[model samples]
Target: MKGIPMRINVLQHTPNEGPGMIQDWSDKNGYEMFIYHPYQFGYLPTADETDMLVILGGPMSPNDDLPWIKQERELIQELLNQDKPIFGVCYGAQQIVKTMGYQVTKSPAKEVGFAPVYRRDVKFLNIPEELNVLHWHEEMFEVPEQAQLLFSSDKVENQGFILNHRVVGLQFHLEPKEDNVREIVVNDFPYIKGSVLNQTSEEILQTKISDDNKQTLYKLLDYIIEK
Candidate 1:
């Protein structure tokens, strides 16, 4: 690991919602990791300092009237312009789409808990066609122009998308850990209203451990880094 470059930065939007499995992957792989919390810390890092940028999931919507939302969007645009490797999850995905000139809106059906994502016909850098992934978001993002659609759910068509292979946005929680899912269910359950909130904690536990999904996520990460 001496010659290996280790420069990975994870932009965390919320304290409770930091990188879950991604952190583990990075640590085990000897990649140096840094967390930039724009919400509480009020400091944003320059895109040039980071090799890869991972925007983690959060409870707030991208359309929310928060100053940090705009700041984050601007940083996303800058990163996109630099053609840096970027990965986004849930709200982070929405922000990526919004930064690329697409709109993020509330989905017709609130997608909470585990959901199945059908692989699209389009081939990613080397991603699989179908996989079940963890989902816990009320909002979904519109596919931006020139972005390749990756995965889709029955409720939400735009579950995952790729922008020129390097930039990927996923609506599902590919990096969700057991405790992360449980914490979201316990603390963020009240915010999830309607039928989406009907699922019990037991049901959530069952869905988070889909081995197939975790394998697919590893494939994705490998592809992203290699590409």
Candidate 2:
């Protein structure tokens, strides 16, 4: 008999910020994906029913005291308690850090558009020393205790981290394709400012989406799930 497929529960905040390349990854891996819009439906899956939980990016800050946000944090905490695998992006990353008793504050600068993240003493995970990836967040998470710092950019000290070798949080977006980048730029251009680290809307749209970024994202997902 064929084995049952793993279920990936996605917590989506807004319509514009979908799973991007993660959906493709799930399909390729034969994992069943169930996207939940807690803002609209006010419902979330329990840790028992979810094989993997994906927390996608959004414009809202994880510091918001909204009911749905609180509930989502609770769900994330339960997942952590059960040692379930989780992958978090942008605001989702902040949520994970916040759930782990850390502060989510405004970043030094709004890291918009494509930027290079340097590897920061990360072992066991095979990633390039430097990689250009999409970043469109104004708030960032403080690295939690006992978490391995993965990558860091010039503007953001905590670009990524891994906890218990199963939960991953990324401040930069490695799962965005060209179209996905376009949608983010269009929706989040207002946050982009004129700074050394920030990019203009035109520049953000003009930058090429590298396949290496997607491959890196896939590698991370595989690593977390197989752990």
Candidate 3:
């Protein structure tokens, strides 16, 4: 008999900020995708029903006192309690750090476009030691206790981290598609300032993520599954 397909539950905080390349990856990788937009109307899946958990980026901070925020953190905590495989992006990554009892602070400069990062140290995701990836957040989390620091950029000390080699948190936008970028830029361009680390709208739109980064993201997903 054929085995059951793996189920990937995507917890999205915003409607526009949907899973980009992640949705494509799941369709091609034989994983069933279920998205929960608590902001609109939905309930988070039970831990037993979810094979993988993906927390997408949002505009709100993890520290926000919204009801959904608390519920989502509770769900993430439960998932972590079981050592579930998880991939968090931007605000999602910050949520992981905050859930682990750490501070996610506002960086000195907002990273509003492509930025370079040194793949400091990680055993799970095999990526180039150095590469420029997509970015669009201002807050950075301190390295959480018992979590391996995976990557870092000049503007943020904590770009990525891994807990128990299963729960991965990434502050960058490794899975953003063209539409996703356009949407965020259109809706939230006011946040982009003229800081040295900030990129202009034109520059951000012009910078096409190369196939190398796409491949690495896929490999990262595969690593999560195979783990």
Candidate 4:
């Protein structure tokens, strides 16, 4: 391990979506965190200076023809070049998949509320057999050949993956606080269009997130940082 007080840089695509447990964990662990909103501003920190990279969820797809999207991928490539640990959530995970030359497309069955992701195999990650996590995306990606599949959901087979053992990507949100959920529900109301795999906004509100997801998130953070 490098040491205490790691420099973690977060790439936020929107003001509505902020790093929830990520920021909380970083603060508790005393890791210096810096957030960059490419949508609100235009600048990327050098990869070398950052010990880890965190990509937060957003409304836009990774394949969108936006300048910031391209720039985000470029920075991700540079971070990969530096062999830095990276944690991506939802759209952030899609960005990592796309940067790895994989394709992300509209899901046949999208998840708009809480869903269960079952563990495929006991490899590096110490995840549960099945864990319910927050879901709010209609797009999913193919697992890259170089990545190890970690979890699989009914709607999306590729629920979680790890690249180079240090980089982790999750299609679901383990880091969501209750307020985060409320904010997303309010902002992404359009996505909750009541698909077969999706739940109604009221249904989502009635559901309570399990504690195991947040606990596992802490374990995963430790795993990446320790590696």
Candidate 5:
């Protein structure tokens, strides 16, 4: 690991939604962390300087008319061309798929709340056949060509995918810590209506966090950092 700082660039889409569990893991592992908040801050990190890039979930679509979306998509494509380690969640995953010539459309049913994701292929992931993962997305992205399908849910077929074992696309929120979950319940409750998330904020607080899911996330982060 000499000469490599294990630096991670986090692209945050919303002001309230920042690096959650990823920040904790990075801090504990002594990895350098940089954040790009497109909402408040008007800039994004350069792909060449980033060893690992994490694109956090957002409420916007990948095909939105915003200039930043286009810029981020272009950056994703650039990173893919360079074969850099990339991890994208929710809308970020959608952006990755879009950048790779796949389409991201509205899901037949919105997947929100605690849902079970079954492993399609457990090659790199260290998780069980079925695991409970946090969900908060209305759109789902198609798996790009040549990507390995990893996880899926009853509602969405493409819950997770791997590209050349270096890039990952996750439709669910794997970085939701206790505080992040609470914040989402309090601040984004109004948008949860008519979706699979029909529980109250107090109900969400009582939901248990599976150790398997946590371990899977750690394994993923470790894999990316080691690569």
Candidate 6:
């Protein structure tokens, strides 16, 4: 590990979908954090300014014709060339897959609540066989040509993937606190359609946030940074 504190750069797409426990993790680890709202203003950190890069989830699709979206893709590519540790969630994951020359398509069914993900036998990542995580995404990415599929859920086959062991992308969320969950639930509740895969607002609201998920997120962050 480097003796100096790492400078973590976060690309936040929306106000509601900000990094929850990620901020907590950075604070606890004494890492310097700098978050930028690229959707509002297209100011992303360069590779030199970032020791680690975190891309948070959002409601927008990676295929959308937004300027910041395109910029983010280019930035991901640039960071990959420099071998920076990059972590992405949901739409952010899609962005990474898109940057890797893959398509981000709609899943057979939407996952909108706490769902279980079965871990694959990946040596680099030490995740549990089964974990109930928060999911609120409709579009999903495939495991790229040279990437390892990390987690898969019943509804979504490609729940998570890791590229070159340094770039980690997760479809399900394990970083949201209760308030962060509530914010997304309240802001995007109208889009939730009640189905076997999609949970009702009440069910999501009633389900307490798990501490294990937070710990897993912290572990994943540490793993990515140290790799």
Top candidate by lDDT: 2
Against the true structure, what is each candidate's TM-score?
Answer: 0.91, 0.96, 0.93, 0.93, 0.94, 0.94
Deviating ranges (above 4 Å) for candidate 6:
1-4
Q: Ten consecutive residues with minimal summed lDDT in candidate 1?
A: 191-200
Q: What is the C-alpha lDDT of each candidate?
A: 0.80, 0.88, 0.82, 0.85, 0.83, 0.87
lDDT over C-alpha atoms for residue 51 of model 5: 83
Residue-by-residue lDDT tens digits, candidate 4, 134-222: 88788887889988888898878988898776788998899988888888888877877865555788878777888787788888888
Determine the C-alpha RMSD for candidate 4 after optimal superposition of all C-alphas: 2.1
User: Which tens-of-lDDT digit does each residue in 13-72 have in candidate 6?
Assistant: 888898899999999989999999988877988878889999999889999999888888
Q: What is the lDDT of residue 164 in candidate 6?
A: 78
* Per-residue accuracy of model 2 over 104-206 as CA lDDT, tens digit each: 9988877777889998887567878889988877788999988989999988889999888789999988888888877877876777875556567898889
| Candidate with best TM-score | 2
**Model 5 RMSD in angstroms:** 1.7
Task: Give the per-residue lDDT of model 1 (tens digit) for 69-124.
Answer: 89988888888888887899998899999887789988978877776788886664
**lDDT, residue 149, model 3:** 88
lDDT of candidate 3 over 1-227, digit per residue (tens): 98999999999987668898999999997789999887678578888898899998888998788888878888888888988888999998888888888998888768888888888756446678877888878788877889888888897878888777677888988887777888877887777786556578878878887776778778777776675
Higher-ranked by TM-score: 2 or 6? 2
For candidate 3, list the clashing residue pairs, or say none: none
* Cand. 4 Cα-lDDT: 0.85
lDDT of 6: 0.87
